[model samples]
Target: MKEIVKFSFISILFILGINIVSFSQSPNESSLGIQIEKNPEFRDVELYELKITQVFKIGNQGKDSIVLKAPTTMQIQSPQLGLKIDTIIGVSRYKVAQNQLIIYFSKDKIYDFEIFYSYFGNVANLNLIGGNLGSFYYWDANEEFWYFRSTNTKINEISISYPNNFYLLESFSNSKDIISEGTNKETFISRSIQNIPLQFILLNKLKYERKRVVKSNQYLYIYLPIDSTRNLYLNKNNIVKKIESQFDKVICFFDEVTSRNIDVIQIDYNKKGRALGNQIICDSSFFYTHHLLHEFIHVYSEIRTVKNDSGYFFLEESLTEFLAICLNYNSKNRDIYFDRKIAYYSNKSHANKSIFEVDKNSNENWDLIYGKTPFIIHLLSLRLNENEIYRILKDFYIHYSKKEVTFDDFSLFLRNQSVDKEVFSEFIRLL
Candidate 1:
């Protein structure tokens, strides 16, 4: 009976806590906001350790205690900074859990204090990709960009400072006070930090030849090392034209115009080939026409506004491969494509596992996810007309483009389409 009462009391507190967070205003005000300063020191070529300093202020508005959420990655320096005012006490305790740094303290009558800490590490949010010309990093690519406070926390002001030689090339920031010094320092201040992802490019000024190719309703931005000869220069334009033609065919099939600009980075010394959705990082040796189209198909299928982790491979990988086949089916390589596709699907390693269970991180058995799953889509296309199959996919795209999607969601879409019930039944059974 005692244990039951304890559980009941805890459940009541949980319910009340949810209600309090939902309905009531927080009993704390930002007297002095957070100021974050980051300095990056190069450890090696394109690798650096960043020292981040964050100073924050909190004022207790009521006589009741309050808690604030910080990043779990935050390392608080010992001997916390604050005065021991009767009303305004320092943070008495802190706990890290659920990806949150929970700060606890006793409330004083409108008392405030400042806390500061410095941490040194490789900024996971920042990646320095080096090419023959130079290196650059994208602000949006950092998963841990907002390392100070939890989202939805009202920050009155924010200021971030970068290195001296880093040029703020492009900014999608809504923050004001955007300034750049002659020595190549950039700083921006925001009154209220918007709860949106920050995406910008910070480029170290280097000698490079950049070609901006604009074709019919599509754009390609290519960056190459300036050391290339005139013949290689012409080859660069030819590569761009070939990729543009391939993209044109995909776009024409989908009946969708290009929504985002594509960037290709060609570095002679860097041979790490990758397609980062909108950006392609490759050496000229690996930047062939087929490789370009494979990556561009990924760019075409990036309809999700927010990523849904589970079963996202269906749209990102499987659908992409299926579309690639469609793109080549009418071409001269039709027989070759089908032969390779059959061999890939017939590989017996992952025959037992369902394609719906496949993930992007499946390394050894990636052929199951990327290669075998296309057969499902192929079967659907064979059951229905090609146009009707694309219509179903496009309809799925329209519904889940701006939102996360799941395997269940895809199944429902297939069932709800204007196709034969037997066909849909067979598809679901195969899954």
Candidate 2:
């Protein structure tokens, strides 16, 4: 099955080209329309490869030319063999840019175009079934949402067709937005959701498993692949206990909790750690580590800060890491972690650079964000107790939960945190 998947994917890689079918129509008033059709197919469910056929209908009803920038692939992970443009109708010309298709339409014409493309989406987490006879594949389609730019382009609808046996596990869409759900297909109509993106998860239920644990204020869902079910079952009790304990600690430190459903999906792919909203997707190996806790803290500490803001990485990533380490480890281990981080940062070229100088867009500044910023927080924790640190953080969270904040705002908040002026000034100098 795996070999078949690989062969099919490889064969599709070389089939890239535009098959243009041209037609003409009378020009009309300026307007644009969009409709998307998505078909996800799995020749063998045991393999992680999913073949997706995406058909886009773009109607340009204008007297002038227009250019549209359409994304080639929506998933964060690039397509295995790039997208193949199987068919194109009513397009003057198109060229591939970096992960985008710059399509051109001629002036004084009406074009009702259709673009059919296929790409292999390898975003699924593997679940072996019946000792490798078959497998169940699951993945979140959160990043599968389409993004295109055009003036006054109205999306008609998006239709998704999957295997009849596949299940729509979860979605962030309103139930009313789901226009139709037949045996093998689902359609979502874009009524007033022009600004919101659709998010969903799909899974094959043959060997997939999920556990839901409801606490007093929070609901947790743990999704495990079939191969890991035995180990998960054995550790289920301890897992729940530890999660609850961590939740309590976080709530206690923050003095508040957001009552929402959190999904922790154990993915098979290496280096797949991601935390968005209340969802935590990570490799199975990091499930019980502080890394997971770091992601968890992000949910509670998320602020509406822009990437251009000074110390944006410090406020988001570093502070979250500091709190996660504090909650997950004792003083001894925490000290060791901070010492290692300090050592790493000390060797970096930007060791002496202030946290305010870290650019969120530059990969080179990541060490400062992850190492020096957290160590700075650790140093502050030494001058003031952890409880005091949590109090200040709790106050900061309250002030900027859903509001935009900058490093200057945070620095000011810390300076006013009722700590000793000399100690606070010393900590401010570290940043």
Candidate 3:
């Protein structure tokens, strides 16, 4: 009799908690107002039972889908209907009848947030995006309700009161249509870049999916269509190439491997196609190449020197921008602005600064790192001998390429080369 009573009690608590989930999804979720943040990453949302009262169609402003993010996965749900299941990175996507993901909270629970960037994929009440990951945790003891006070991602935050509601307004300039060339091989290379902000969309009518990617290599071959507006994109590509060519003489090697291995992309909505994972954005009349090669140089270089650890920001970024520029200069000799930037940081003496301090101070002088650090490499090349620096570059790539490197790991690499660490240490101090 005692065992039976205990089992019933436990079952009752589970039932009640689940009932709370359903109740929380009801219209009364927020008592003050619902404040939603527009974040693609869903990193800044604080959920505590804010229920959905209505579903507003986003119309032209929003895409026809839903977004859900978790630490290990990110999944997108099509707007076509009922609760459907999709999966990515281990997180599963589920549908909510209402356009909102309800979070229920007790009156005593603490919640706070502010507005964030609006790429939640939809603009009007027309769409919904939710998440089940990231530094996400639920605390049952706090309020006997599912409560979340934190997440892993960061963007501007938004706060909501119980009853109050705020509309999220987002705007984007008119862009071209998409041509989806679905191929996993193409996606693999695209995803490898790791810095592009891209959204993969599925077109139900045509039965296709595609994404805009970004990555930067020294050489980029862009094909433009003949339409006047399309030709504009071509012209822009030429101008961009001119700027680089004037600066560097690249030992150009053409590899059809990229386009051949990747999926076939047919032009869809926009005449100009953009690759977010790699640098390319198209407008009807023109497109721009935001090549990430220099950025990649730093990223790859950091990986070359440092194993992936906490001490990467300064050494990676600063050295990256610096070395990338050096590589650029080596390829092309033209640099007016880069020279001046290098001169500035050269005075700073590469001092020993905390990684966080450098990162935090970055908003003010980011270009300096990219420009100056590479320039330092140039100066070092002259002083240490270009052959030596080149050897370092080649060796760095050979050893650490494709593998994770650490800061201490890189420091040791330098020590082995008999490079004076203290010299560069003081160099950063000037910054």
Give all TM-scores, in the order shown. 0.64, 0.64, 0.40
| Candidates' C-alpha lDDT | 0.51, 0.57, 0.32
> Tens-digit lDDT track for model 3 on 77-170?
3343212222112112323333233222233323221111111221121212212111111111112112111122221111122212221111
lDDT of 2 by residue, 48-150 (tens): 3333322233444453445444343432224554444555566767765555655667554445655555544432322222232123322333343344445
Please report the TM-score between candidate 2 and the true structure: 0.64
Residues 331-401 of candidate 1: C-alpha lDDT, one tens digit per residue:
34644665676686675767667765754446665666666667777777878977787777767776776
Which residue runs does candidate 3 get wrong by more than 4 Å? 1-292, 295-310, 330-338, 342-356, 360-362, 420-431
The TM-score ranking, best first, is 2, 1, 3
Candidate No. with top lDDT: 2
Q: Which residue pairs collide, candidate 1?
A: 87-108
Q: Which is the leading candidate under TM-score? A: 2
Candidate 2 Cα deviation (angstroms), residue 45: 6.7
Better of 1 and 3 by lDDT: 1
Indicate the residue-level lDDT of 244 in model 1: 63
Worst 10-residue lDDT window for candidate 1 reads 9-18
Clashes of each: 1, 0, 67
